[model samples]
Target: MGIIGINRSPSCGVDITSKNDQEVAGEGVFIEILRKKLEKNISIDMVGIKVLEIEKALIDIQRLINTK
Candidate 1:
């Protein structure tokens, strides 16, 4: 399964999580926990979405679905 999250959120960001108003390259706490918990059962592919990149995100999601 795949998850789409906001890029600027602290709790739900996938690739650009927020930290003290700075953008960092990391996953959110929940994503970290979920990854470990579901590592054995399912393939998890996550992507960060930005408001400005909605079109790109959609394309990425389509590609993910096609591959699966």
Candidate 2:
């Protein structure tokens, strides 16, 4: 399975985060830590999305589900 998180969150962001009052590209601290732990076992997908961007998020969710 994959993880879905807030795109602009500082703690739960996956692909985007709020750093120094600016949005930047990177996993949040929590997600980064989790990824490191999980990577030791098996690789999995992580995605970030904005609540207002439901359509795009849905596509990402579909892609994650379709990952083999």
Candidate 3:
């Protein structure tokens, strides 16, 4: 598996690995912009072990989307 580092926060660094390397990937600002643009269409799936605060952030994002 190839590991790619993502700058999330000082507390929790992010990484993405692939069984096969051909899959496309991006992180941080790229992800944020992609997510914002994707809001009207679908959800993106992320697999990882997250810290408590990061999980909370995810929950907050879900809430914002759900409330909208």
Candidate 4:
């Protein structure tokens, strides 16, 4: 129903990603690809969080689940 990724990851980021040493706003490679693949059949929500902020990430996941 939802997807969660680490922010600033080159392959999994959802909101922030490292590009040539600078952080930019965009989805990472994998998430972007997955999104495109899913765009045709579903409307899943995706979110990103810092790795150290696992607690917040859990809350985000809960929210994603609740929206269903």
Candidate 2 lDDT over 1-68, as tens digits, reads 88999998999999899999899999889998999999999998988889999999999889988995
Relative to the unseen true structure, what is the Cα RMSD of model 2?
A: 1.0
Task: Judging by TM-score, tell me the better candidate of 1 and 4.
Answer: 4
Q: Write the per-residue lDDT of candidate 4 for residues 1-68, one digit (tens) a residue.
A: 78888899988999998899788999899999999999999888998988889899889889988998
Residues 13-34 of candidate 3: C-alpha lDDT, one tens digit per residue: 2332232433223344444455
Best by lDDT: 2
Q: How badly does each model clash, as a count of residue pairs? A: 0, 0, 0, 0
Alpha-carbon RMSD to native, per candidate: 1.4, 1.0, 11.1, 1.2
TM-scores for all candidates: the values are 0.82, 0.91, 0.29, 0.87
In the predicted model 2, the residue pairs found to clash are none
Give the candidates in order of TM-score, highest first.
2, 4, 1, 3
Better of 2 and 3 by lDDT: 2
Q: Model 4: which ten-residue window has the lowest total lDDT?
A: 15-24
lDDT against the true structure, each candidate: 0.80, 0.91, 0.41, 0.90
Q: Please, what are the lDDT tens digits per residue for candidate 1 over residues 6-39?
A: 7878888877788899989888788778777888
If ranked by lDDT, best first, what sequence of candidates would result? 2, 4, 1, 3
